[model samples]
Target: MTTAPVIGPEERLPLGAAEADPRTATRRRYLMCEPRYFTVSYSINPWMDPSAPVSTDVALRQWHELKATYERLGHVVETIEPAAGLPDMVFAANSGTVIGGRVLGSRFRAVERAAEADHYRRWFVERGYRDVVMPESINEAEGDFAWTGEVLLAGTGFRTDPGAHAEAQEVLGVPVVSLRLVDPRYYHLDTALMVLTEADPTTGRRAQIAYYRDAFSLGSQRVLRHLFPDAVIASDVDAACLGLNGVSDGYNVVLPREANRLATELTARGYNPVMVDISELRKSGGGPKCCTMELRD
Candidate 1:
């Protein structure tokens, strides 16, 4: 069997934009590395119904599958240590606005999850990432973050707290749009929304969000009016397939293989949607987006 040669950090996988070319704006590069995104699941997830996490073989296979997809899309997939006790941690990656390859590792809000932060921090700094932002007062989970290039939306009253958002505003130096997450079931803002395309001039396409039902400030239709006027409301199938949980590589979305109808509709509308088997993962309350940590250019 042909094996992939292990390369140095500089030779890490690179995924700029999932679309054919999502970097139309004046980004530093047409392609770049986003190694700060990921996911994790084990037998310990409280959200899982009657089942436990996948088997070690299944878990490792899924991890490798996601890693391969991210690498194919041009991203550096860095595997972190699995925390048997922290089921929500697999998606953990170094959180920060990437400025010249410097990653700002964040402090997690939940004490149970905070212990895992340092693991990623050391990982980033050891790899030569400078300007790391470990906020003294702010604590955030990587899941609380979403990268839109225009705004960094953070959710409070859920896994993330207010202190983290306030500090992130100052630390990240970007507009911190705070939304009160209505319930804890949708752990973070990302649990509901993901940017599938770049900003559109006509309808502000990039501004359009493919989100799901969760406890948040804005009404679904109202959000559509205010944000994406020409938006696609996630169908029931999309919702179940990971309407809000999958990652988009220029509309070739990574969803549950069970969500073929959603994929077909998205494909008809100029998206190239794809799926991965996450039946076991979903039993634990996650899907494609839940599995990815996208660092787009």
Candidate 2:
């Protein structure tokens, strides 16, 4: 992968104005759940406020739009039945990470989400995929782990344990780059960084990523700078709105409408910035990426 210098100050653009680049034509399979059981039953992150009222109806509508957008882009959208009591199950990305058809299921740290780990594992196994459930450490699957084509970018210091890094490396048979999550707001690595693509279509190299620098520890920040020097750094306003929690299919980046600055930067990069409003889901500290999980076949 080629590295460029860190981004400098730039002007923001209007939301959803970015043109889609045809070069980014990679289609992926994704898993999602309707927000039928979604609600802020408890506060696990800074974005969640238990006292705040949640509208399940509005949440479902927004989630539907997100699914429609993915389908419009020619990506396969699969469903996992939402259980009655697991409100947070709508955040499908937390279930696990799938690479090379192998699944490493999550072990949620929060008591409320503990049961979800097994449910997700069963779904993968039932589909005939190999599922490995970590027996010892706490790890929230794709929430803290990202695949960069060549290596796995694992996050620690907030939700996932550092010990899982070695385990992930052993299980996946790939090198793991352990990045530390320092900010309370961006608790998960997926919330702080969005993997744009696994490989650049033109260069045939590791694809790019966009991230919030302030969310990582100094050492992790250095690693990001060294590895993805040209990564689009999210502004405070965009980062605060959960803009980095996005899903990309090489050409189009699907993110929140509030992330105008991020949309502008992505537009300038010869890629498409597909914006969607999932404000209702944000009450539970998630956005577009949280609602979807990439399943490699």
Candidate 3:
């Protein structure tokens, strides 16, 4: 059985932001989910990864428009300082864990990535999230984590380690299902899996994952199987054009403006979708999901 981590109810949205009509607001709120505080990183040359960077210029435009889309959505965006002499810091969103009202900051696996966690910590603390724990023994990255109404699953052997998993589980008083990660380019779980749309207690698996279905070895499959025994596998055509990484809210998805077919399908399904041209950012092997941090879940 996978280790089960119990999650607590998320607190009400922070008080300082200006109030808006919830009815007209584009920001979608999960009934039991809200991200109290969040941070984001910009892109640099990302061609180091072979799978990414097929189209560089188109991806960058989309990355900028992604920022604008979120700003229009009312998420309080916090920017991190550029790491000195880096090719890409866009994946820095995965540096910590928020569980049971406590935020645990972690050490990063990549040497170039270590500074990002500290930046996240300051931002979280400023927002007054209590019970924050600075990780000492292990490295933890967001790619290793998946949240469900019932538990938080953290993976090992990828960017995050088993030591970090155990620490988070104990601090949050929830069972954390730990599994070994598949290696070589599914470096972050987000590359392989992401919840494109999420309701209060349920989440939609985006078609983007189809791009990586053949990559995982054995154990990670067991981890996925444990949770999504009946998950509907998405199709390839839907996966590539869907801007699956750019999903926001349970009802809305942010996508590249060029994805007409997928956008048409989403609108037909009752989603209020938004599109930004991120061709330049994609050149570095990232998509909409790589740029913005979802603050209100």
Best TM-score among the predictions, by candidate number? 2
Q: Sort the predicted structures by TM-score, highest score first.
A: 2, 1, 3
lDDT tens per residue, model 3, 175-249: 777656564444555544555433233333331111234335586676567566533343444344324444444
Which scores better on TM-score, 1 or 3? 1
Query: What would the per-residue lDDT of candidate 2 be over residues 41-154, giving only the tens digit for each residue?
Result: 898889999899999999999999899888877788999998888999999999888888777888888999998888888888888885555546888888998888888999
The TM-scores, one per candidate, come to 0.72, 0.90, 0.64
Off by over 4 Å in 2: 1-22, 200-203
Identify the runs in model 3 with alpha carbons over 4 angstroms from their true place.
1-61, 81-83, 137-140, 197-212, 230-244, 255-273
Error of 2 at 138 (Å): 0.5
lDDT of 1 at 219: 52
Whole-structure CA lDDT of model 2 = 0.83
Question: CA lDDT, every prediction?
Answer: 0.53, 0.83, 0.50
What would the TM-score be for candidate 1 when compared with the true structure?
A: 0.72
Q: How many residue pairs clash in each candidate?
A: 23, 0, 19
| Highest lDDT model number | 2
Per-residue lDDT of model 1, residues 96-135, tens digit only = 3343354556676546566666766776677676667776
